[model samples]
Target: MKIFVLFAFAAFAVVVFSGRSEVSQANGRYSTGSIDAPTGVRSTVNLYATKVGVYWDTVRGATLYRIYRNTANDANTATDVGTSAGNYYFDLTAVAGQSYFYWVRAENSVTSSSFSEPASGRRANGNVFPGPFPPLDPPPSPSGNSVTAAKASLGKALFWDEQLSSTNTVACGTCHRPEAGGRDPRTLFGDLASRNPGPDGTPDTFDDIFGSPGVPKNNADGTYFDSPLFAYRPQVTKRRAPSYLNTGYSPNGLFWDGRATGEFRDPLTNEVLIAAGASLESQVLGPPVSDIEMAHGGRDWTQVAAKIAAVRPLMLAEDVPGSLRNWIGGRSYPELFEEAFGTPEVTPARIAMAIATHERQLFSDQTPLDRWGASIEQLTPQEMNGLSLFVNKRCIDCHTGSLLADNEFHNIGVRPQLEDRGRGAISNNPVDDGAFKTPTLRNVELRGPYMRNGQFQ
Candidate 1:
């Protein structure tokens, strides 16, 4: 666990190893065939058969690709072909008798969307799916004013409410405790922080935190409330929780594995990708569908919603007319919406915007080091020496910049005893084998059980 102790100084006598990160184009969220080109650039034809197999150039930012082929004989008989995220699909659909049409799209755990254009050729099949996503929003806060106080308050309430959980006992705040640097470290047991059942078949109970029931021989005191949130065995999470501080700055994607992105698909946007770019509010609401996190049993959102709807009134609030009204708001949902977002239409977009507004506020620009002593000029001589050593050891290479993260995944090659795959599971990329994001050292000394694995350095 390379705990960096930074000591910045011009040690003329010492070799200070420091280098800037590659200024790669900002990561984009636009998938192929999704970006809106000018009207003049639109192509009319869908399929042009020229070659034996369909092939296209590599699209940027795509890790998985799919080709949708519709045969000329039938408009409804469409074939779905799945390819790796970065690779183009084979053009096998351009059969001689079939006037085949092809449309391509990109998808990963976080995002899925259509292509911007179609490639046409007289005798050859051409794929016009733009090979990459539209670049990330160039700037932050794409379509709104700064987040507000009332919105943040509502967000905090929603984030912590157990009614949001499948069992109606957990909320976003359960895992992202502020004191533990805004993340849960209680993997073994404790509070609403986690709901994992023990292998010993102990009964769920809040006293030990997981609320697990019947993993034990006789611990179910007959009054414990550890009923399975589902009818089947639960599906534990593949990974642990991530923090929130400084995450809103990551506009293009979210999560260490990027399992979530700013361009989450909500019908409210009508477009597959909109308002993507990291926003604390957006990142915070994720994982309620995870079986081990907040998911209902092992089911997805629909199942979880149905199970909890009777006990949880908030789910029905979706159709109550006002775009922003919930039990949290005293006035009509529309009135609350006007106050929070200046609109009363009550949209998922605005809901996301409001939660995002509150989340961005979680950015902790204030730290003891930031206030009392930091920067090249403010450090004490000893602390400065430590920082210098930190940079010398190549720590600064990853922990660079004001936010102190290059935001790239690297394989530190820690002891791989744990089940966690870090970024590998989210990306399915070999390059990220046993790798994790280089976390921000903004308040490292205050955070413990270091590393995403939390192996206790």
Candidate 2:
């Protein structure tokens, strides 16, 4: 007599046969019966624009493989996408920008194995760069207040003057320097104090942020106070300082969340100064009163105006630009104000206009990319290859245009949305969670430690 037994494992199967011991001496045999499930499955889109390449390790007992796909992660929702004799499949129906999860099953003439672990991928849209560069739109200026040489000069002085801060140590230029591509360079030093624990409130984690350092916590009387987060040390901003270079070109709004609207309103009077196209002017009014950036607690525009009135222009700054120095020789803030505006009286609106005017002059159109696009110069072979890859890989989808940015917000899945609400905080939309504005690539090499949180070097 003989007995047959079959056993199935998670990934393989076995068959056994046994004979009665007394009959022809006890004998045992084992044989393979079922196929193993596919393993080491992965997906990619680097090779083709319209297809997602799904690949896997060849199974020992598989004669053919069946591919299944769905928009969600669940395998139950997946439908048969295709079949292949080899260990790979090209999903031509995969759409660009939309993510798809995939699974593979090994099969032979008799039966099929269970589905393998799922892999996810998406196809690139393959939108190439448009032709030569186009001229950038003129920088917007506030209505009734053009950018005059005198106004820009006054704004330059204010921008670089440390005395504008309540502690007389920080200025607009303290964090934004031209040499560093209008971004803070101090974060590159690896200062532990400059780090802000993200929403998780933990340190040395993936969500840790490298941010710009500002003045310590201060009382309304300009005295230092212990901060809950930093103690006596200088307070750090929640987000990294964005580059000021070429910021004038952004028309929708300013800042990572686009909170700085184009309408410039007088801080004190709430009167609309610039009705539209004055995002630069609207942006300038923020840092001066921000307690963490440049001011003491409860500091108002009245206090800022009074402080400017009391201090001489650029009193704490050195190596002033020659034109500004010549204009400011033996002059007071009131005198500079008189030259910039109609009279010597210092006000918040005039201050914003002057600073915005100065910032508008910081155009960066002389880059190598610009020269190549303009047909004034040629790109190297390596550069041409890089440009080709940049387009082919679909990096140009969001980072498009002459500015190399779409000036829109997108959540690229850099981190979990719970860690940072990002544009969602401003827009109050769940879909905008973790979305950040696309930054310009002009002089990008000079600005290291990129991203809104400065998570990448």
Candidate 3:
């Protein structure tokens, strides 16, 4: 009877082992075994604003990785956010100023491994400052262009008026939107239509530039013309549109290349309009007549002035701000101009001065960082760590002071020097090759597709 029982036990063990083998080999691709769970899981935040980067040590046979995320620390409750072929994944949907827990699992054709240990991270709120806010210097203004309510009001109308463009479809505000932190929102498309082939003149290359689209090419007779590069589409700028936010704080020139110098010169008469501290005035004058931006080919300041003189202020705009609407109250462009410049004439100089006056009022000093500096708020621990890293990493060297920029040029090597000369072309100096202006970090989270080429989002 004992011998019979031993034989039965051995037969049962054999059947169990055989069934396990068959189950393992059920998926033909993984005849050997199941995938191992990924280990050494970690997470980081704010590498890009509002993004969480989850990483793990690679599993030997991992054909793919699945990233899981949760607001709580419980991995069991975590949901799969995305998949990657590599060991890392960025959660772009992560909300700013929120903490997230992450886990990763390795997968093969046959099966997925167990969930990795949960790791936590949080995107920096950008509310932390190392010290108290410094005193801000007064914004520079040209001698004759002091900011006034009347001038600024007229300028606001001009800025939003699509009628200012020859096509009656584009305005200064079209590119520099307030909600986008004063940059072009179209650059975020990240498609071929928004890309500019750098100096290499080749699309889909390393030197490809993400830039802002302007008006389509137009003949002097207000007729559309086909462009060699864009065909019937709008011509794009070579560089990304710099944010107009906090530009009032810039003591030097404006634009990525600093082509708009401090001295504002008349476009037609060769007379100096604003001799010093007028970079804003100089910058505003370029787009009105540029064939690639707002006007027809060979358009002159006289044509722009004549067009403005004929049209009603902000005629093509919708949802006009309540304050501006009340101020306008059925006024003509001539009346607005007369109230702004003490005359009915709308000259190029008056246009620039009025626009600059309005732009100067766009000060962004009431952010969370400012609130923290004023002792009205506190920063999270993760944000404090980011502040420490910002200083220790020497980021403050180029980005200094209250404005968070030195108002200088730098060549951080986003691309090769030959691709875009930047400040070099403006200064006619080889040493400044690839040097672009240091933009302010204020409200930087809103202005994405960062850098002069808009390469990083």
Candidate 4:
């Protein structure tokens, strides 16, 4: 009877242990139910201009969270921006003035749960964003100014036409001398004794000209002398003439002080003349009437256009390029006008437009620096070192962008004795005193007589 009891106990123990092992195999060694979705999802934008912060209540068994983003509120367009193990996620690609939508899903080894309710956030305003620089090709058209071969041809003829001046001697090409870095070679406006008499009739005063010595002197015949050997020393230019190369890219004001604004206004009427982005057109209209550059006092655009239309094209030019000659083909101004414009009518607006179009074509983006940017050629070690120094010295702060010009104003303490107030003269703000717009350095090597007053070598 004792032996029978021992055998029975052993059988019962084996059966119990085997049953425990089967239960473990049926359950699977390590497994859990699908992860629960994150709850209480919310988004917030921090002090960083371009960052969005996403947060959610932690799920019970979530090992990770997948963050999805969409520009719109719709879930169909959502894409996984990134993943995070924690409840909080930070997105760095957020932009100002744009709303962002985000949703999160709790994920683990077993499964990923459904996405949480969408959350939205937006960056603060006043965040100035950077724009693209100059493009590889010349801009076919600026905001308001369009370019055409016919218009450019007409502009080329007008640009070199001496009849635009009162004496039929000076042209746009006279002061903007193409051979001389697209600027006048003259040190003074015309000759010596061209200094503007201050309130006290002295050399330096607040009322003195910024960069111009004075308006050119008219001869006894009422015509301005192109060049004369003045017996007395002449007052040099208050500022050097800036080059026209690549100037088509300047979207705003022109000149050293930015007095010639981009706003196009009618000369006879005070109405806003052209469409927006017509700064170049506006600028071309200014120099022709200025007594110092191309015209005498009281010379209006009507007189200028009539003078041009009546005379033969480029009659006063010493040498015309073969292409330009072919363009004119011994045609009268009216005939050329008919080809350029639909009619034989030549208006001041048309003249300005044509000049601006031709000026836009004077692009100079083939420098060694530009070539290096294109990767067509490698920069020399010395040149690379020089560029590195340029950045290290903080010269790149204002001289930034593809044109190497920030197009913003700065006061670098270049005050002369006359103390030419630059942008302050335009804005009438005391803080803007002595501040000048940054000039482009695309072809700086070719444009020497540097600085606003041509002071530096």
Candidate 5:
């Protein structure tokens, strides 16, 4: 009786299997009942000039993968871009300067799996779209006073012209020694003493003491006077000269105090020229007439213009390179002016414009750090350790961004508010009393005598 029961059960199992086989044969497809959900999906989106490239890891049973895109972090409104057989897709509609979010899912005839992790990317020039910062679309270009061959050549000539100064012995190059990373070579006063001008334009107050050291005090008529204490002491500068390297990249203001503001007013007529975005132009308008730096105190731009127009360009620049001399050497100031500005004119506006244009060319991006950042080379273990420490200590927080400078003001406890007014003089804010703009660290080792007062050595 037990054998008979087992035989009946075996016959029932055989009939069920036979029925399943017959059904599969009739359909001409073997159904594995239900397909397993595709797993381990991964995706990547890369920005390009004309398109965005997307790719993903292949799923085991996925016949195709569907790409979904979103402009924001929320994937709820994401739309399916398209499907790819091999786990990759190129999004041609990716717009430049727009941030995009993406995720992918595997799909087959039977079913589809959930989306993978989302990835974010932007389409822009890699040079300008450096990460850890926002995209710099319409990428950095020369300002309206941008550098041209003619303008730059004229500017280079003006930069070396000693006639631009009241002494006829001082030139822009006198302090901005090009070979010395465009900073002053002389100590000037061996840690001399000077002060920031107070609200009344006098540097005698307690708030002004921490600024640049003793600039040679000017006479009432704007001429250099023999110091009553020591006549042989070299004329002292109020502040250390900053390097011009990569200064062209600054968009807002120049100088330690940002006194060379963005407003580009013609020094002679006070008429607005570039209106805005002309910090370099505004900066060049200074020094040439600054009583202590390059000219007599009351010497206006008109006198400087006259002197520049009447004399030969770079007449006293004996150390000028032969290549530079050949490029702009032979032409007189008027002739060079004609080639640069369509007429033989040397207005204050033209002078500032030319000098600013030439300064735009003095950038240096070939340092070891720059090369490593660009992936052109690798850093040694020591350099890597230093860099790691720099980041770990959060030094990068302020000394960051494309130019490696925040360009904003910070106090950093460098001095007391009563010692240096710094940005406070400009903004009139008590919180900004001692706040100073963070300087760029690029090629910093070569441009020493650091700090606004040259106190860092």
Candidate 6:
């Protein structure tokens, strides 16, 4: 009896302990759940129709969020969308000018969990929320007057006309194309550098005026270029063109340095001698003459004599309204230059003036914040909150809008490895240090590779 009681007790103890172990195994070990928000997020945007803008809740550690938007509009409208790990939301909706309902799920590994819950949203009747920036002053009125239809068209013509260049190949549009976010990227914008010269060489301005009849004029016939043309070498131009999107808003002159290069500097002041020389207007005309960027024959304007003569005829006024009179090339330069600059009157100064004129009028103040602040409509709660954060954070101190830069230069921590002084080299002022021009953030989200060095993030 004693042996039986002892064996029974031992067996019972073993069974109880084993049962406990099995239960624990079923539940797994440690713990698992969702992460909390790492950054602050404005509430979802409620819009004018049934549309709402949906965004993720907690960023936490997740690298991506798979999103799906749907509506009664169509089957194609519903599909998978991916978020950029740290961003608040994805504009992955397919329904244009229509409302949508959306759902998002956060994921760490390729296989994470579902969204916290199905959140609904539809786009509102406005542009997306802009990045933080300052309240810009009202853009200057269309300078002089509203540019006429004829002028605007002419400007675009000269803008793309390669005859404007000394090479008879490049044009204003070569560097500053409206389609290229209004600026040119070397490899991106038709691979121009592979075909052109450096913008600053002296041989640049030697091309015969496309429509003007004369020897490519020297320092004498009111012409400016006469020197060795620099060859195209990317090692020198570390930074490429920024957009000309809203250039008229700039109170200062053109180019990153504020003063146009390639033109004569005051042998005395270096203050960009405009007296008998190019105003900012005239300076705009210099690039096409560059041997490296647009000039030819090793900067010898003398060698490129025929090309220069051909230029004079390009913008010559025609006696017949729609026909080419003097510059009997297959196309007409004057007619087009007339449309963009408010007149067909093409001259060195007028060409630049026309370009400057068109630059002044590229406005698109249609973002969500504009509704609450600048635009005629009102803003939703989230956008209003974003605006509050934008102002309170002092992003406005440097980035003012609709064209967001102050047009001044700052170091802003770019190309730190490069040697030599930056703005100081140009100004020779101790205060100028490494300052580069402040970039305007208009249409910024679309324009990436963020910094001056093309470091995309």
- Report the alpha-carbon TM-score of model 1 versus the true structure: 0.52
Please write out the lDDT profile of model 2 over residues 65-99, one tens digit for every residue: 79999999988889899987544567988887688
Cα TM-score per model: 0.52, 0.70, 0.70, 0.62, 0.64, 0.48
Worst 10 residues of 6 by lDDT: 20-29
TM-score of 5: 0.64
- Please provide, for model 1 over 208-261, each residue's C-alpha lDDT reduced to its tens digit, 9 standing for 90 to 100: 123222111111121222435323333333344566555667743677666566
Clashing residue pairs in candidate 5 are 193-213, 193-214, 194-213, 194-214
Q: What ranges in model 3 sit over 4 Å off?
A: 1-138
Report the C-alpha lDDT of model 6 over 194-251, residue by residue, as the tens digit: 2222222322232101110111223322344543421223211334556666565555
Q: For model 6, what is the C-alpha lDDT against the true structure?
A: 0.41
In candidate 2, stretches whose alpha carbon ends up further than 4 angstroms from where it belongs are: 1-132, 135-138
RMSD of each: 19.8, 29.2, 24.4, 28.6, 25.6, 24.8
The per-model lDDT (C-alpha) reads 0.43, 0.71, 0.71, 0.60, 0.59, 0.41
Better of 2 and 5 by TM-score: 2
TM-score of 6: 0.48
- What TM-score does candidate 4 get on C-alpha atoms? 0.62
**Model 4, global lDDT:** 0.60
Model 5 superposed RMSD (Cα): 25.6
Task: Kindly report which residue pairs in candidate 4 clash with one another.
Answer: 192-234, 211-238, 211-239, 212-238
Better of 3 and 5 by TM-score: 3
